[model samples]
Target: MIKKFLFSTLIALCSISAVNAQSKVKETNKLEDPDNLASQYFSQVMGVAVDATSNLKLYKFIYEWIGTPYRFGGNTQKGIDCSAFTKAIYDKVFNTTILRNSRDIFSMVNPLPKDELKEGDLVFFKIKSRSITHIGIYLGDNRFAHASSSRGVVISNLNEPYYSRYFYKGGRILDSVKDELIEE
Candidate 1:
């Protein structure tokens, strides 16, 4: 009788240990899923639904540079200007190179109306100047990512009073230019 009781206790302990191990494996798999983690992180950052972060590459690039400080002509994480940030995104995410200044970059695109703007499009601003002095990458839902002189790298809405006041135009890269870049 004593031997049977001891054997029964050992079996129960083993069963409990196996169950706990399985539970941990399930939790680890959930945490390791890159798509799920990216969706959750960007959704919270952009203040949008999880499904809205469908372009994981764009969002991931933006996430990595989100809080970088603004510096005129700067191009790295230590400091980056609007045009530099825009160029970086295109270079890394789209695998294309864009002009380094706002006005010149404007020439590479076909001007788009705000209502027709799409993800990965360029949004230009006159700011305090008459020319295109600032630029940002459109991120859908009226939000854009840019390196602001006052706020460093951030996402802002087109409807914001400050942005609307100086909004210049939206643009998409010309198909010819895209093709040329790809060929090179």
Candidate 2:
């Protein structure tokens, strides 16, 4: 009777240990999954649904550049300007090159209405100028990523009073334009 009881207790302990180990492995895998981690981090940062961060390349690029100091005509990670940031994202995430300045970039896009804006579209702003002075990459949920002169690299909302007041238009680069740029 003693032997049987000890054997049964040993088996039970081993079974429990096996189950615990399996659960830990599953948790570790979930944590290690790059897509899962990116979705969670970007969803919180962008204030949007997790599914909205489906474009991992775009979000990861923005995430890595967040908090970079704003610089006029600067293009590197140490410092960058709004149009440069937009150009970098297009070149990296979308695999296309865009014009250097905000107004020139605006000319490359097909103008879109505010409500029609989609992820990866360009959101232009007048700011203090009569022409488009600032540009950002739209990240869905009315949020856009840009290098703000005041705030450095940050994600902002279209509905904010400052942005809403100056919001000029949203624009999407047409496939034909992308093809043309690629060929050049």
C-alpha root-mean-square deviation, candidate 1: 6.3
Residue 79, model 1, lDDT: 100
**Once model 1 is optimally superposed onto the true structure by TM-score, how far is the C-alpha of residue 105 displaced, in angstroms?**
0.5
Model 1 agreement with the true structure over 1-184: per-residue lDDT tens digits:
9999999999999999999999999989877788888788888877745453467888889989989999999999999999999999999999889999999999999999899998899999999898999999998889999999999999999999999999999999999899998798
Candidate 1 has an lDDT of 0.92
- For model 1 the local lDDT of residue 95 reads 88
**Clashes per model (N, Cα, C within 3 A):** 0, 0
> Could you tell me the TM-score of candidate 1?
0.80
Q: Against the hidden reference, what TM-scores do the models get?
A: 0.80, 0.80
Model 2 misplaced stretches (Cα beyond 4 Å)? 1-33, 182-184
Off by over 4 Å in 1: 1-33, 49-53
lDDT (CA) per prediction: 0.92, 0.91
